[model samples]
Target chain A: MDDKLMLMIPGPTPVPERVLQAMAKHPIGHRSADFSAIFAEVTENLKWLHQTKNDLLILAGSGTAAMEAGIINFLSTGDKVLVGTNGKFGERWGKVCAAYNLDVQYITAEWGKPLDPNEFKQALEADTAKDIKAVIITHSETSTGVINDLPTINQYIKAHGALSIVDTVTSLGACSVPIDEWGLDVVASGSQKGYMIPPGLGFVSVSEKAWKAYETANLPKFYFDLGPYRKNAAKNTTPFTPAINLIFALHAALGMMKQEGLETLFARHDRLRSATRAAVKAMGLPLFGPDECASPAVTAVMPTGVEAEKIRSIMRKKFDIALAGGQDSLKGKIFRIGHLGFVTDRDLLTAIAALEATLQELGHTGATPGAGVAAAGEVLNR
Target chain B: MDDKLMLMIPGPTPVPERVLQAMAKHPIGHRSADFSAIFAEVTENLKWLHQTKNDLLILAGSGTAAMEAGIINFLSTGDKVLVGTNGKFGERWGKVCAAYNLDVQYITAEWGKPLDPNEFKQALEADTAKDIKAVIITHSETSTGVINDLPTINQYIKAHGALSIVDTVTSLGACSVPIDEWGLDVVASGSQKGYMIPPGLGFVSVSEKAWKAYETANLPKFYFDLGPYRKNAAKNTTPFTPAINLIFALHAALGMMKQEGLETLFARHDRLRSATRAAVKAMGLPLFGPDECASPAVTAVMPTGVEAEKIRSIMRKKFDIALAGGQDSLKGKIFRIGHLGFVTDRDLLTAIAALEATLQELGHTGATPGAGVAAAGEVLNR
Candidate 1:
């Protein structure tokens, strides 16, 4: 019972025992040939996972740090940039832009709604003068479990000759984000979400266009400076001291990911998403976001008969299952169940069964016993 | 021979097994109450190690990131600051200042020499206009194994009414910084050094004075922003997803350090430094920095009859020991032996004995066969 706290949150996902053991290995000097060999291999594997031919750099920070670096490195001050906001993460990117005194243009929607790609297209077309330098979008809004149409938005960015900066934090591993095909200029993600590792390391991929913009970008930066990272990365090194053991964990996790293959990995996540959503709906809980735009990483549930906090509390205290509550304004309104990163069909069924038992125990007349598990099993079987 | 690599580098120091095992534990949601409890405990212990009652914040970054945050969070653009440079890290702070458009004044010294406390005194005394907003100093220059006279230099900064922003990256846990006693405003370090953990977490301790400066200081930051971190720390949370596993490692390592007690911790480092210095001296290798200014964390040896890189290569290849070679202009001229963190007296003796064998094997006449080990033993035994 002590170490059995099942994580059903979007990030800080379950890690495999192999990856955990890899992290426990003694750290070697970052400058050594042994480390360089591992670093080079890990970098290549990360590129494979990201589906990018661009320079994928790793930083010793969270997803926010990677997102901030993506925003700051490729644009100068006062440059007009369109930022999409629907959730906490999307809105935070706008704040990052404003912090650097960028001329921010927001394209916002309701918290649980996805950003309209048409809004981006319209704003980008209006910038015929080409003053707009970049477009910041969150691919998956973690707070609301809404996945934005980044592919369509990025196409507009390409047409407008503006860099596309995206936070694919939760979407990167759970869904297909073919960076090269989409022509996304910048894509940022964190380790905990999809890498199947612990937090602390962030990954960022930069296309040629983003690197070109780097030449003229006038933002003042040091630790998050991408140029040195690119140069050092070429030599199979990092500009700063990296999280050594975390890198080891990533190396092992990426190896596992490569074995799973991208197609299977994405398919697994898609199935997990369907299963989690199906289970929640069968319990008579309203899904916070619509099916069309729901994230493949996590499913947000808005219970009618039961309290969201109560469900989370019971899940945690009774079943030892940790569910994430809504962040920001959505607080206590919805509870999110994450089935991303190292989660399996069996794990989804287990979570669903526990949820049904909890609902029944709470005397929720709308929900039937075993209905949630049956619904999840149907999706998993399919 | 495969997994037998021993790290004797300045960073990525030897991590204790307890810490590594702690890091290998499954990561929980950072927002969870369980995580919050661990975070609060970790924060308290971190303050104990920092020897400060100030607001100590941790970032998922390297030491450079911590130092940059310390610089940017307390000063505005074009704020006059004096930076001391005797080695690589010292020079990096100046570059960080320049990147931020800070009007920087330099206090310079040779790489192998300690910073003249009088130089800081002279600069502070000359600034009758109080134009200098802060003074950045590296307490232990990791690149050169030189420890600057921080106490003496800090007094001058106090006299000048300028904030003392110090980089204690390689010195914090190795020796006493006594942040409050010295009235130091900002002190930054990394987990890879004296914290006895594998890299990734950077820590910055801020005094009330630095927080006061934070009200007006604006350098345009997001991820490295310390205010939100301060606010979150009060609630036992971080502004963003932290390096969860690394925090676990820190928690374990801190517990060990607490058990050992601060006095023993500092004394152990002191003994290691003396033993390493004595061994290198008896081996007829010139110490890169003078004895009075040598760092407790690492020892740089300038061999007379052996190539530094060659020594490092042979040690790494044949004996599985990883030693650090000189950086920048001093490259290939010096090799450094780290004696910080989880390093023990026996480890030091093993390294010195191995070095003696290496010298003999390399046909170096400058060093006697058994002199290094004997010398190290004499000092270590005392």
Candidate 2:
């Protein structure tokens, strides 16, 4: 009980001390002027982090709720939507759409492979009626450590006159995702990822184009309805009782992010990603995604001869480090190392050292002693 | 900002220091054994709090989300449901049902008035085909400070062979709501109200009858689906990333409640309610609801000649006390004082004193000095 494990999972990331303290503060009335001021600041800072001048609404649920909101709020039943599937999250978009009885055209790629922008373009070109209402893509697939090319796919969607809805759950604060620049109509993310807060709040930024669709979109929505959120946002309040403590934590976390600045934040993630990949490669483990398409938030490593679960167990038991296991079909095949949200160079180094020790303990002796640490050190020093 | 305001809103009540400190703890992996144990304990404690052996699942949203889940997961499109509407939350149930395209037969009562059980009984009796799938009622209508007769209405629902869905957001911990004894099919609540925690987590306890209805209910649901929640609950986990910090806070808050015991908790609320009503009467103000039907959680007062908004502003600006303003149609007509959750005798005395001063300051001199506080003290001493 005295030992606290390092949380190196994709989300439920390590929260900053300031954010935790902020959350610990006595709650204020949600409708009070003080709360409105805090909420307004959080909204503006979230916009700055997302690099979007769109309507970003906060929801009190997981990222999946935001994803479901993105789908149901802008499209009706039987509406044609082109969904791209490359990992668990990408497949989730299709499932959400199908649950709402949408007519879905799935564009899938192999797991750990990036979705081809040309495939989406071809699909749009083949739809002679231009009935595809929206094109949904996962910006960073946490499951397989792949970053889909959002700029190209969104451009294709724009050219085809279809709305671009993106799931930026693990990408918003880790890297550059300019919603307005990319012409993304809907971009959704969660607070636990890249925001350095615990999982409770979900955010979605909607474009003017998406609001126009919302005028007539006939999907059933109550709790996830963005209309009331938009209405309440004008007054710096939420339609329902929000997660007030999380909003306090978000305000503190966003202040920290503002102090760090976006460029430095992105570069920090880039450096950590590079250092982690260098360490994994030096340890003779195969990176799941191609180097060109790898995500900056989490890195999935495919063990050659050792059981992935065994390595994770060793890391948890001996090193007190919690690594993310693979999801869906990738379970026990690949283990993930997350470096998102409040993860520092020191933390990454510790994780890398633990991975090396665990791999060695599991009889994977292909790598030289201290090789992985040295590789990561060179990247960190630079 | 130096003067911390006392939060007296219906929800987002003042969180205890122990709960806040518990929430400030570091993040834990949701799938870890540590989190599982905490979650399982929280679930069991919640069941004890709910007084039911049913499946109680925690969700990361407001009470509205839990209400929506209760409606959508047990009824499909075009399913007829009898909805009782008295205040904002009651009307919200019908709106949620309407959003999901449910055939809602609304039994209406005026704001600040409790619904007549005969209306539901008559409506159910008139239905020759027995097609009313469920009867939804708000156990404690926060908007009007009215407590509906759940025991009586549920008896009517049971006799009519209809499921009883209850919204116990403001009633669960403040009063005795034994779901098993009351025969409630689905009882929903939120964390912030009576649980002495901040808002984020919504809970719903589903009975075996509701689970049977779930098998045939065809409403579209993803994030709020109880099927996955039930499957994961066996292992003490959630289908999505829960608001972990709130769960920690809930554990501490529930422990405090357990130590205090349920009978003591209900008596505390009852004492506070009596004190508040006495103070309101002593101040020569009109209580909104009938004395027999007033809620034990909050007391709504209809001030004569003085604007409710002005009183609230005075309370906030001068004394740093926040009293809840009325909602929707009741706005400006009534103001509510909440004494639920972690409120103490000193807090109630202070609120009463402040209310009297504010009323007098607003030129209402009907009441004598210290009369309200003296009345409240008499009740507190008992």
> Ten residues in a row with the worst lDDT in model 2 chain B?
B1-10
Off by over 4 Å in 1: none
Residue-level lDDT of model 1, residues A1-382, one tens digit each, is 6899999999999999999999999999898788899999999999998888999999999999999999999989899988999999988998999999999989999999988889888998998899999989999989999999888888888999999999999999899999998899899999999889999988999999899999999999999999999999999999998888888999999999999999999999999999888888888889999999989999999888899999899989999999999988889999999989999998999899889888987888886788889999999999
Question: Model 2: how far is B293 from its true place, Å?
Answer: 0.4
Q: Spell out the clash pairs found in candidate 2.
A: none
Off by over 4 Å in 2: A1-3, B1-3
Q: For candidate 1, lDDT tens digit of each residue in B118-212?
A: 98898889889999999999999999999999999999999889999999999999999999999999999999999999999999999998999
Top candidate (DockQ): 1
Residue-level lDDT tens digits of model 2 in A48-74: 998989999999999999989988999
Which ten contiguous residues of candidate 2 chain A have the minimum total lDDT?
A1-10
Q: Evaluate residue A191 in candidate 2 and report its C-alpha lDDT on the 0 to 100 scale.
A: 87
> How good is the docking of model 1, by CAPRI class?
high
Model 1 chain A poorest ten-residue lDDT run: A361-370
Query: Which pairs clash in model 1?
Result: none
lDDT minimum window of 10 residues, candidate 1 chain B: B360-369
